[model samples]
Target chain A: MSEQQKRTEIGEIGEFGLIDQISSKFTNKNSSTLKGIGDDAAVFGSGDLLQLLSTDMLLEGVHFDLSYMPLQHLGYKAVAVNVSDIAAMNGLPKQITVSLGLSNRFSVEAIEELYKGIQFACEDYSVDLVGGDTTSSPSGLVISVAVIGEVQKEKVVYRKNAKENDIICVTGDLGGAFLGLQVLEREKAVFKENPEMQPDLEKYDFIVKRQLKPSARMDVIHELGDLGLVPTSMIDISDGLASELFHIAKNSEVGVTIYEDKLPIAKMTYDTAVEFNMDPMTCALNGGEDYELLFTIGQNDFEKIKNHADIATIGYVDKRANGLKMVTKNNNTVALQAQGWKHF
Target chain B: MSEQQKRTEIGEIGEFGLIDQISSKFTNKNSSTLKGIGDDAAVFGSGDLLQLLSTDMLLEGVHFDLSYMPLQHLGYKAVAVNVSDIAAMNGLPKQITVSLGLSNRFSVEAIEELYKGIQFACEDYSVDLVGGDTTSSPSGLVISVAVIGEVQKEKVVYRKNAKENDIICVTGDLGGAFLGLQVLEREKAVFKENPEMQPDLEKYDFIVKRQLKPSARMDVIHELGDLGLVPTSMIDISDGLASELFHIAKNSEVGVTIYEDKLPIAKMTYDTAVEFNMDPMTCALNGGEDYELLFTIGQNDFEKIKNHADIATIGYVDKRANGLKMVTKNNNTVALQAQGWKHF
Candidate 1:
């Protein structure tokens, strides 16, 4: 084949594939590096305790739209997403460094508003704002946040530790953030077509807020610690429930079976999806940006969390031969498909 | 004042002023956070050892010109700059997270080339490529790198620890990287005017390579450890010697006096600046991105490194009343001015 033919577009392999291809070439050389890529966060040993590091970058047009998303909420969501990565490792976030690239169009007051949100998130999560680099971008705004957290050696959880029969649990609700985006987009289109039209967004406030500012499930992480329970495997549901479940199954080398009825969706989200002429169950399965915690625990720990109101038992681990499947309320079993957020 | 009149443009306050305004509002709340802003890197305590964290973001048109800079070297420089931050803190970097936002214009082959450079730097610095986020960009490429390092509690250094009698020291020569950029820009302009003209860059290879692949002075950091010496105050010369010295002076609350003749400049850099009709001394003092170490050692401890070939003692700390001055070769004591890289 010619050299030109050998050049594959990044869109061909997708984001996860690109990450795997890149990270696979790098081998960890330091003994302090307890874990590298292929997890929610990298783990490193600093004496007796383990330290977790995770980073997330958001670009203006790709990850968010400034027209509908306020700068403050953007800043808050950036920190919250990174904190969620730490929470996925069952760690407490302590410090964060936020880097930003702004165009000349951004005023000092605009940045202050963004930082106001960042400060609020920092206070909410109790994470200290440490250091970062601020530079000018040629075009749009860019934000990258790196968070460091601490977890005990015995208590640290990874994505590759699930065993057969482990119960799958997800915290809070799902799909609200995705449905929120839909409402915002619809309103934006209407406003764009006719400037005189005022957006009637009061009804979809909850779902819209979920998209604008989704909080990380650090509270659930704290509650698990208080209950003396550690998840066998855990991950944050940023890329929809099916995609995150696929990550756990792929990493732990196990099959998953989730019941459709057990999936948690807020009433507002379901109603909004119906108003948009979308299936609520499909949104729950494939919509992204929920920022919820999806974890698995041994069956013995089930009794301890079963009585909890926010925790829901969605599924259980199975043999790899069974593959990933979901059972509908009508008792029809079908193969689960992961339709994650595709930026490309 | 009206609310609209109160709005301040970022360019008016400049980058440092904006940073000061933002970071000043944040107070570190975590006990583990030893130090926050106003340094090359933030200091934190992780068990018995102290950890350092630093992050840098590079935007496509702002930080580099893809026409001249290879993706591989851009990747290498990104990691090197962050590693320099760790070295400034007297720490050994163990892990780094690199996040990238790419547009569709880049092919998978382009990304592979970039990662190859990242891998090379990882090997060179003995740092593990830990975790990062990859997403699509709407316009150009953006790269953000975060590094974590460790130093003994007693050995960790800060910018505010210089003494009045401390001897100022610098590693390697300065201004090469800056001149190198000038040459590249000239060539780019020439090529744009006439694509048929083959650019001649072989003569400026030394400065060009310096611009493309600047290495962090990790060797000096290791040698300092071997000599059983710790800098009283230290900072990496990323934003020019004058700017960095001002950082030391402001943070340490001390005046600085340096000899103009003592400044180190490579023959190539000096000659290149002369050819460009720029002052060579000015370039040496104000041209940034040297990636060299600027540190202060107490007077009594200077004897150990005074005779070293790579170590140049350019000045000494003085009383605050003296202010920051540079004694020119003509015996004129002039106040030093910091012309740092301005993006806004």
Candidate 2:
């Protein structure tokens, strides 16, 4: 290839564009692969059930900063985040394979400490640590985890299943993890400015923990199963709530209208946002990494989960021509925008 | 957590040592995970059959220098190596997930070129491209792939099954890939020193392609089954012949005796080694990344496969007390040594 032909930028095509270009040329030949490449996890059909597979990679400087991030929390976060992808497909994670590339700067004990948190997450999620590869890197650390999960054929969910007038629901709360990251960054800056100053992180512990050790909403998935309800469409909130909403809307060929008054924001998350002079509503809409489940349910199926403690109805699916909109508490309407994480 | 504690160097323990240290602490709780951490791939007992899981990571500088390597070959090699691990387990690869970390230096076109090679490998290996994550990295490219394969319960082979008097065998030829890398490195040095000179890689095309596009020996694995022979023990020849032999011996509690004259060396590889003034036998024994299957078969299964063109009986397993030794054409015995690639 000539030098001029090699100078195109990845950002020009964007992430989704690149994925479309890559996935378009391949065809799945195996009958076992019932679904591939477009969902939270690839679904494989066994005789009586479906097996889910998903993988994620975390780079050192790009994904986390060692100065503020504890190795154990990083380990836990890695497992939890990958498990969240499996949960998004309404599956129970059974096993995970973690591969790590480490530099000599990491000691055996440091690696042990990281594994300790990995073990904790495994136990918490009822998953097994099956296999992994560890090798030396020239610089920094790289972690790639592949998770396997199982679900019944009828229980599996996809992003393109939402219907007209379906109720959009979100579990737990949003923006807390994003707010938590903001607080950690502020404290990191304060510490860097003066050697004598110590980070006063006690008051912001909830948000910080949300950022470091966020849990996947496996409880919501189980409860929905118990209630005999399958979400019309589903996705986990990793790349901000608005971005996920756009994904569901685009894939389902529908629009969404979310009520700000119904948005679930933690008290601490709201107060911290106010302290930082940021809009709490915007944080809930655009803040990411919450690892919470967001989905839409058929109108008749809503009665079963209406009283669930952890779930809240935030909106309803509408015609695409109506567009995505948010209703403020004062009855004013505004267009919803997604400020997704742009790594490039 | 104290700094006063002494640190243990990873080199002291080596790659296997570090892996043993880490894997020993974690126990598998999920019944689906039939085996973990010790073999070429983890065995999953889903039902009547066994599922094999294997993962490998290739870092930019540590694994390959992009300056001399094409992105497409890098992509193809990544998938092939992971598939080779599955082949080592005597299984049929069914699916693979590829996660890539891209830096700003890479363009969308460049990524598409990489995926072109990936799709070609997927087609060649008959594996489905399942799910994967695409994220941006701070520096160079990182590709991590996890492969899923299947084998019958009775057909599965492990590294610990070699017995006394088992015949050791290797597929295809050895040392070509390593010598190919040497030629490429020499050409790279010439190009770096003088920008005017173009690399004359045409003369070394076969060896160079061996280095860049080594295919997994799945065909040999399939052929062995047709011949009604199962390897008592098996491993892929990635970390040189001697090191891999040491692995089988250590795991199986046996020793080996190989003949230097019996080692398979391609004509081109032999001539290139001679041109480089390196010992051809040494190159065949210690050179790595052949992507060839090395196995030990019971004496009863020897006649069934001896006539096959690609497979060769190189040696036999011995008692642990005899140790690993090589017999020269002159009837001189020498202790075998392994200097596998050391990243540290």
Candidate 3:
């Protein structure tokens, strides 16, 4: 680098812009690569059953605090988060490879506790723990997981497949995980100020668990399969609902019209957000790490999932000109903004 | 975690020991998971074409020094290392997902330079960069890559498949990479002590390049396919010749016997080792990061690869009771110990 050469900070473009720049430079040469770069998982294979590959990396200080998080939940969340990517593709996770970079600060027993959680997740999701590389890190603990999944070729969904007037649906409630993180941070701060503080986490157990060991919405995918319902478009809500809607809208070349009143927030999550003096709706729209499913289905397929207990029909897809907007209880419409979990 | 509990350091078990312990506690539940935990890459898929999944994570301070290693070379090496795992399994890499943790210290242009090397490697090795996650790191740069590969189910090789009397062969020379590291470190120390000193790395270019950006032997894998020869078992030589031999021996339930005279050491590597007062043979046996191929072919297939220039006939498989041993040019035999690249 010469002194005259201009340097651009990564924060200038944000992660999505950087991703787009990187993905645009490469082209797929293999025919088996049905899809790449844009979806939750990369799709490949020539058989009737296609394969899904996705990876996620969590650094110790950046992604987790470890002060309030047990190694067990950290391990479980790492697997679940990768598994959620497969679910977002309407695929069943078959196997995962975990690569860890550990510091000497972690003992053998501590590492075993982490693996125990991974084992539990394997059993719960019916995915096998196959291969991984474990090495030493200079500083914090690092966990990177890559998962393989399988889905019927015809049933596979991408973020770009939504059609106009499609019914938008979300599995389970949102914002709980974000609130859980907030509560954990608050408690950690409290504990730091007073060593005798015991965290008082009993009152916030549900939300804290949501952050620590959020479940991937595999159940919703299986149920959709059983009902013979296929989503036209799908995405995992790791970056909050509003941000994910932009992904679908941009990829599908369609606009979204979600009802703010239709959004589902758990009773506890709603009350907890209020306690923090945060608007529950804002938390639902912008708070992330939910690991829930946000997807769109054709209007005709909505009948099949209409009465489902966990699935909520939030809104409908519209024309690109309409843009992404939400209808509030006061009958006013406003454009949706994504504030998608920017670590940069 | 309890008051009376004992904590064991990970160094006590070492990396292989920790991996074995973790692998023993888990069992494959998915029938699609044909080979898991023990192989170079996890094998799955039910079709005649089997799928291979493998991941490797590299950290900044632990794996390389940016003081000498350019980011471009780092990116190239990261992808190549993962691709090597696929080649070790007798498979061709098709697609890869890279997860990176970057600190603010890097510019967008620096990342682009890094990706330039990755793109070059992708073109060189014929692999696709399908998906990845890039986030802010709290400390040093982190790179984790997972690759997906395909091979004929019957042709896929595992470490446990070598037979008695098999001819052991290695692709290219060994010890160059390890010696390259010694030169770089020595130059770094010299330069650190006196600011005016240049590295004077001109004569050591070949060896230094070997350490900075070693190539994966995918070319050899392709050549084997063209020659209609498949090794009974295979493993990439990332952890030196003797250590990899032990892997092949232990996994195959056999023993190895290699002649010291036949060990292929490049002229440059041998000279560099001598310059550092290190035994060239010891450098070949225990020095790591070579990224070459070590495998065993049935005695009948010797005619197919016997005349190959890049392949060296170094040893042969023996009975398990015989143990891993090396015969010196002086007509003396010694047990080979694997001081596999240990960071712990």
Candidate 4:
């Protein structure tokens, strides 16, 4: 009856695409809203310093399946992800509030288990669990966490602060979480086929742990602060390396050139990828949920962090005209593309 | 074969019973956490003032039906409900972070409609929209909002602060929102039964509006501030008045004696309740979603607010030995029972 029969699928736009489209339409009108929607955490202009706030929601079935995922690990990951956002802003997280939608399926013991992990994360990050709401949901579990952190005005890092020739650095190895997920899914399928068969997850424990309990890079944030180094641009690798890199490149008005060989991948992760019949390089490029810090630094600061074991130089910022390209191990240049998680 | 197979239904315990069971388990570890998980919001000690942090989550089907609920109203209601928590704390709301989980069913235009309402609430409260996460859900829409507000150390009110002999006061009126919901549900049924019939809702505009687009009691907070009136204890009437009164009684370790005659009700709400064959008195006591301010003031401060057109003195706080009772029109004393929203 109507001419508007066309329906645009969200999967067509992708997560990053949808974010770009939505964020582009809204402009921050409040003076206190220093930054919005573009960075890992939004920065607010507090009277004395910049206050950073970040929020994240994790849903059951989509984000994590409760059958294989422990309630405690889910709680820990929820807090860690929000902390990761604050860390991406180069700020020290001080407080967090967790809101939970608990279905009737969860017992008192289950909730206690969840809060146990939440308390553990609070102790680890030195954040105060200030406030939260717990209510019943009709189905499934929903956990939402909001973290508050503070950074000095001059030290606050944003995605748009990168300059041309700045070196790109990423903390820890990539692709491990993705490979770990693949291993778990494979084991789950096998177990489903034959209930008598047990999942031999012990051998792939490293990658499995990476997927289940990834830590926020607060240590790196503190280290950089102690060393008097501030990142020129920064974002957390929640939506894969290439997607985050594109965010930096687009926001900072620059192009990036990376060496594929320089990308950090753990040996176990690479082995697991091969076992799954997938390319480790592709996994590293496109896998989400890494929760590692990706940042840009000035050339002069490179000498300061060169010897740091946790930090690795993966790329360099380039002029916008140069475009985003990667030099392969065999000395061949290729255009870099990002294919992030498509939950829609 | 195990003894742990005993499954208990959560509906048996009800929402308040479930909350009481859960709240008894968490002991506050942070010295800055003055109050946690007992009132409308939690109170944390900041250097010179108290920081009020509150969070809420709304799930589709459980909290709202999209067939009758507009996306814009959902967003506004989400913010308003969170801000109402701050109002209950006798605090001025400062900032809010909203996290949304949308299925592919939501179009870009739909999401825009939601944000427009959020922006409207932000402007109304002079609060900044600082940070949030936007991601895809598996099935239904999920909205979670975390709000932060501040109050002077001495001015901050808590549910535990009501003392014996304090006068109970309520802002605006009650039972309107719940009556409005009844009207909406009836219309929805009518539409379902006859597809060609346009729902006759003209006579029930006020009540329907109360259900659809309720405003937070920020005006009460501001007026109290201007009058230099710090309530002895405060709570927003999100749940029915009876339930909230019980909360004050339990938390403050005092008994409440509310006058049934003094309970404020709108004429339209009362007439509509009668037309629907619902008890207006029961609706005032146990019907919820009013978003009105229910609070207690010291006896000495009564002169300051006695002439306020919108506020009514309902009753007074009694000793714990007296218990919670309502004085009926026929001079009969009855115990007040709280029938809060039960999701299970």
Deviation from native of the Cα of residue A250 in model 3, angstroms: 0.5
Model 3 misplaced regions, further than 4 Å: A1-4, B1-4
TM-scores for the candidates:
0.99, 0.97, 0.99, 0.94
Ordered list by DockQ, greatest first: 1, 3, 2, 4
Better of 3 and 4 by TM-score: 3
Pairing residues by index, what is the TM-score of model 2? 0.97
Q: lDDT at B249 for candidate 1?
A: 94
> Candidate 3, A128: how far from true, in Å?
0.7
lDDT of 3 by residue, A1-344 (tens): 78539799999999999999999999998888889899899999997999999999999888899898899999899999999999999999999999999999999999999999999899889999998989899989999999999999999999999999999999999899999999999989998899898887788888888899999999999999999999999999999999999999999999999999999999989999999999999999998899999999988897899999899999999999999999998989999998979899
Stretches of candidate 2 exceeding 4 Å from the true structure:
A1-6, B1-4
DockQ of 4: 0.50
Residue range A1-344, candidate 2, lDDT tens digits: 98647767878877777787788888999988888888888988577667888998999998888988999999998999999998999999988999999999988778877888898999889888888888888788999999988888988999998888999999999899989999988888988898588888899999899998899888888888888888989999998899999999988899999999999999999999999999999899999899999999999997888898889899999999998999999999999998877777
* Model 1: share of true interface contacts reproduced: 0.93
Which ranges in model 4 have alpha carbons more than 4 Å from their true place?
A1-8, A24-29, B1-9, B12-35
What lDDT would each prediction earn against the true structure? 0.93, 0.90, 0.94, 0.86
Candidate structures ordered by lDDT, highest first: 3, 1, 2, 4
Q: After superposition, how far is residue A82 of candidate 4 from its true place, in Å?
A: 1.1
- Candidate 4 global lDDT: 0.86
